[model samples]
Target: MSELLLNHLAGRPQAGSGPGTALSDPVLGTELARVDATGLDLREGFAFVREQAGAALRAMTYAQRAALLASIVKVLQANRDRYFEISTANSGTVKNDTAIDVDGGIYTLGFYAKLGAGLGERRHLLDGEAVALARDGSFQSQHLLVPTRGVALFINAFNFPAWGLWEKAGPALLSGVPVIVKPATATAWLTQRMVMDVIDAGILPAGALSVVCGSSAGLLDALQPFDVVSFTGSADTAAILRSHPAIVRGATRINIEADSVNSALLLPGEAPGSDAFELLVKEAAREMTQKAGQKCTAIRRIFVPEALYGAAAEAISARLAKTTVGNPRNEGVRMGSLVSRAQLAAVREGLAMLQRHAQVLHEGAAHALVDADPAVACCVGPTLLGARDPDSTRAVHDVEVFGPVATLLPYRDAAHALALVRRGQGSLVCSVYGSDPAALGAAARELADSHGRVHVVAPEVAASHTGHGNVMPQSLHGGPGRAGGGEELGGARALNFYHRRAAVQAGAGVQSTLA
Candidate 1:
């Protein structure tokens, strides 16, 4: 591998004043690059974004900003191949997995671009229909949504440097807010490359987009009152960010996507050999193996009918057995390594803790990884676990082992399943598979309060439904409670996060213009 030295984007590519840290290939354990942020002037960078980039972006109308997003889409598409290569090398993901990050990011940007165009030439947005204050309708009150005159600081996770950065950036840029991304140090290479490419294309104004790819020492300290911070990582880190003075004292806006023990439910009355049963098995296994099960939305606990507990466990384990783990470069490798040895160790540690309360249905430890050295390669196959009595198991409900690991639990009925599902405290998503529409709808409604999204899959919509863990641009993401009481990505609604709302009481003539 070539030795790469990544530079931060502060209006342009620049080196740090502190010593840099080396990055290594997760699968091969070889040094790949270095990112230095020891003495980065993040406060100065924020000033540049708020003044230079902010002014230029705000000068453009919604439609003009949409055009810029469209240009970014084209640039990403043109360089998609290079991005896939970087993701595979640095993140240790297969082609299909890499597409979820690279292609997903492009698609999200495109979605926002088209969405922005629909808003026309407006610099601000109207929340709803204007309300009449006077009985004669002469005075009116209208809610106006205007972009905050501040910057957006994105602290992305290791599992999705590509999509994580773009997903947040899409809405922020569309809302006329500038962004500075701080990718997870483990997988900063891909994020840096993409940011570099976009800036090089000159599609965005200087200071409109920036990236700091090393120690996030001064990043939080640089926040202003109007600035927004969106973070995706552990709940512990989210708590730390929430307690920071910028958010607590200054009342700065913040959104967090943290640890979630999401679930997949097989509603009662579905026979072991039935279509719904099979579909649930397929989806549960897929969620466990996709991205090596590093996704926050991935299924950690699976609930099924008490009668089919043993059968369900057997079927899911059989499917997981077919997943071949190895390097992404290999032709038939269905599953790839974790992002790094540190991640692998963390997953193993968490898994071990959960094992005390559950029995292993299928251990991936014995599964030999193909075309890679077991000593150096950070590879692990899919493992299916079973909790004979889920109500008695605390770790199965509270702990999240972020790897290709999942535990099957049994429930007596729909009510029982819902109770068990809620044991997660809160989650990003919960998928229910069944043939009964009314029952499925009821389940979804009940799950909605605790989950950010509830995917209901009947046989008719099975093939068309996006996977349980996939976060779509048109739907809501993030959840309440342990999943983080945050919200994002529901079409134009996402733009609200980057904007401030105010109710304007004005005359009929002034309100008519807003209407």
Candidate 2:
């Protein structure tokens, strides 16, 4: 990276500062540039999106779409290193973490590409016999997964900006739907870079993929009935969007995946000094520190057996103490800064609220790594707390310090642990660590009603475990209540979000008679 690029990555003043104002990189800076809401040209963009969707649907066979997506995979592979560099620079994600996002995102595109190709070999609903009607005869019906004559609007979150945007866009495009992408300003530059790459590849039609770099003012209001809106962000924001008049009144298709207070449970069989005990500690710490703990799937709560609370707390704290927090570009830095100063502040506020019912088990605030410069970056070390009362509102459940932070909550028994996990209302994911299959299954079933995804970790699966902080393309990625009562990504389920279904009924005997 050049010096100018480095400065841009650091979000430093590019030019001389004006009186009482700074010139931080508008691209990677925490604060977003204010867009002129009224001046946005949605009409042209909307028309172009519609045109491209139609053209892409008409011109390309499903095999052609698959070939285009395969080309995208090759393009991404060639630029993988560049994406890692840019993603780390823009979002403070470490190289390995960013690599996972790139790899996972590429795999998602590959999956959809295969799906598109499969659509070609399958028989279209219209392929069946078409009946001719007699004097008083009526025709029967058929079902087809045709593309809806509308657009897909994607509103992505700051964390995993590239992945969020591409995951939705890939599937929608494969299903022959044009997508209008609106990435959160915190990391829009990375998304923009990726989109530019896609456009250069010439895979998508002219208006099949359009981007809104800034605000999306009046965008939702202009949507039609068959239009689809998929959002990935906070539950609070999802609620507001869910209530939009265009969506509610027009019954517009909407899919949401919001941040949730996910948890990890350590069963009694995993006592200290045992392999299972050690595995639990490692899993929790990894979830709390990876991607600087910005992921919605990160383990925010740790549920431990009452008898082993002290030992579990000590093990977790010791591991967290070893985490190296600094600039991601620095060698030996295991954990990087939070995405932005504002996000760091939000984490701090959540910590303050959590302190009301929890005691600090480990304090990384006082410790500093040699390469870290807090004054010049948004950095916070990993922190662990032991909740005084697991059932308390201020304890393990309500608060979500969305950084390298986790709260250890003690449970008297398996039943109590399951009850405490439910106090969070709904979570995107939850994990249980133990070698006992029966015990793990019971707890999993107990919490299955409240969590969207659950993982059982043991000696057998620990090595290959993706941990609690990862969401895959094939899985449903949202939960109920506090986690946003909507889902995204379940094969055809995501594609269906962009369509409307209506039943046409007639006499079947009349159709046969006419034939």
Candidate 3:
């Protein structure tokens, strides 16, 4: 990694006056960069965006704004190799996994650019037909979604440094709002680097994009009435953000995508040796191993029929044993290390709590790592545990280990499986696997009540269905209760966050000339 400065978009590189924080490569324990953003004042930063960047973005037609994003996509794609290399080193993800962060960001920008062109050249969006406010039709009202003059603040998670920024920035820019991104301190190197590249491209207007690398000391305090803040992290942090004075007083809009205990259920009646069984086991193991199970959408609970409990455990364990954990650059390393040693320790604590209600089915020995030293590198093997009494085990459904760890529980019948699924309270996603459409459909319908997405993998779609851990751009990436009850990346619906909706009531002739 190269030495880079945090881009404040304040005309020049931000002066490093604050305490310098070091960003490290988890796999090699090497320093990547020193980040500090102390000299910039949040109040002035936001004021500059409102008067400068926000003005430029809002003045442009929707088509012109969309074209800017399209140009950004070109710039990022032109330098994808560098971005992929950085992601692998900083995030400790394998080659295939790094693509999700680097390539996924480019794809999201492309999708939003095309979407903006389709939105036309209108300045304000009209919601449905104008309604007659008076009986004589002298007065009418039309709902409008207008761009907010305030800035959009993004507090991202550590797991996805690239995708997290682009996904939020795409909609905010299209909606005519400036953005100030504050990535998680532990993994802010990639995000800061990307922000610098965007600034250098000069595709978007000046002051349109900025990033704070180390501390967000006064950012939230500088928020105005029209501003919006989006956060992705733990549920505990979400609760604190929700209760902030700005959010509580309706001065700013807040959106959160918190961590949850997501589950994957194998419906009853599928034979132990059938394709459905194999597919279910493969999906569970893949989700557990992907990104070292650091994803928010990773499966934490696996529910299987009572008859197939032993078989499911054996199959998943066998697949997990084939995984090789080490440095991400090594070809033999199927899975890489955790983001840092601190994260690995947190996972260990969570696993200890979960073991009180379950027994280890597949324990990864510290000495079994390939091409790596477990003491120096932050690596955790694909560990599996089995909960014998599903109904009595509260921690199995409530606790989230947040690493390459998953607990398998046995369900007696259809009702038992549904109960286990609902015990997660609310989840981002849940998958159902079986040959019977009738049973899968029933289970999906019930699971949808608690989960934001219910993925049904039947025999016909088993070969083509996306796995349980993948979050698509077109689908809503959030859920009901514990998952934060927030929605993001659901196509054009995300634009609503960067806009302000209002009902414009006026006479027919006046309404036509309002804009």
Candidate 4:
């Protein structure tokens, strides 16, 4: 055992068994920490958050909560270097990937802080404008939005422990809801440390924010009617969470971001070596390799013109070939290992299933680890598989291998490509690359119903376009159908999740007073 990372209950550390679940570095296989919530009354935690922290936060205005968020940003910034060091040891990530989780979190918190400042001193939100309930001047109606009286429980994925916690917390805190985060066990170290830093700062009220680091056995059962649960993980797990008795009984609000086979489509007008073609290739390769393709929005299916399929495959493979995978601290290493050995095994198994229907264009398994032992290191290079007859392969469309892996599919034309992309059921994002504005607009409109966001990339914006898989704080980050019919991160719209709406019908004078 290295260190016992206790669960933070009501801003106090709750110690568990001396030896708990061991967390190790994926690359070096050295124990980093342990987490256990052996004997804590979770139901009391829910009550503490609602009665204590929730009351304290609700007493403050939006601007006051925003100021608190700003103070947290400063605290996180002061300890950023230490966070980076821990990310390398626990997350097996280099500087760039760690920045996405750490700095990205701080950035989101700061953005929400500035946005909340504009909301002023209002403790509750008004929805739209007041309307007449009757023809007479004496009657009126106004829709009101008030913060829920319970907590927000976040069940996050292992890939983004930091960004996952803050992005959701920023809006919930602003909405006057306390938060309890149960980070995925694999990468709980960084999440635990970040919470430790915040608690040490003493800026937040006790129970305003808490982290449960061990098993999530009884957390869901403690939910009250006003409580909300936001989860990020595989579709299977999302389905399981949905069927939990509390959620099934409508005693809690649930939001999910599940498996998505997101795509990148190169429009038919673009030919080989053109700007659109090159941009698609670059983005596809980057999405496949960044964070070791563990991102929920990573481009898993690449759609290009049938005539230019070979060119796209060769170009993307060239990029993946240059990426070196090993221990994140090593020089010249462009990518790091999977979060754990279990994840590595899962990716390999999924790849084998997809290979039954597709050819391996780039065999990442053949690549050797640069600075870590092959047997101990949980490493895998970027892989590009090609499904020549994509229309016939079910696994290529349905299975999401959460690693540095992607499958290239050839489309006959724009319509053909759209049909193939829809086979993904639904996704978080899909980028259509082309040079024509009219064509790109048409494609984007067609994809709007299936994808939360349709990123249209052209020659003009290629230089400035954010990469395909990068989830920005200012845009919608969830999708419909298999991707989970939940929404998040669309500016102030995200605050709606923490609010309860009601139509207040009253006399004109009363309505005016309430407003």
Give Cα distance to truth, residue 127, candidate 3, Å: 1.4
The residue-by-residue lDDT of candidate 1 on 197-289, one tens digit each, is 888898999989888888888888999999999999999999999999999999999999998999999998899879999999999999999
Q: Model 4 over residues 1-515: C-alpha lDDT tens digits?
A: 47889888865778875468888899999998989877788998889988899999999999999999999999999999999988898889888988988999999999999999999998988999889878875787799999999999999999998999999999999999999999999999999899888988998999999999988889988987889999999899999899998998866999999999999999887878899999998899888888888899999999998998899989999988889889899978889989998998999999989999999999997788989999999998888999988888889999999999999999988899999999999999999999989999999999999999889899899788877887788999999999998899889999999999999988987887765
lDDT for each candidate structure: 0.91, 0.73, 0.86, 0.91
Q: How does residue 56 of candidate 3 score in lDDT?
A: 92
Model 2: pairs clashing at backbone N, Cα or C within 3 Å: none
**Which residue segments of model 1 deviate by more than 4 Å?**
1-4
Q: Candidates sorted by TM-score, descending order?
A: 4, 1, 3, 2
Q: In model 4, which runs have C-alpha deviations exceeding 4 angstroms?
A: none
Listed in order, each prediction's TM-score against the native is 0.98, 0.87, 0.96, 0.99
Worst 10 residues of 3 by lDDT: 4-13
Look at candidate 3 and tell me the lDDT of residue 119.
Answer: 86
| lDDT for each residue of candidate 3 in 157-214, tens digit (9 for 90 to 100) | 9999999999999999999999999998888878887887888987878889898888
Clashes of 3: 0
Model 1, residue 263: C-alpha shift (Å)? 0.5
Give residue 233's lDDT in candidate 1 (0 to 100): 93
* Candidate number that wins on lDDT, 3 or 4: 4
Task: In model 4, state the lDDT of residue 129.
Answer: 87
Residue 177 lDDT in candidate 4: 96
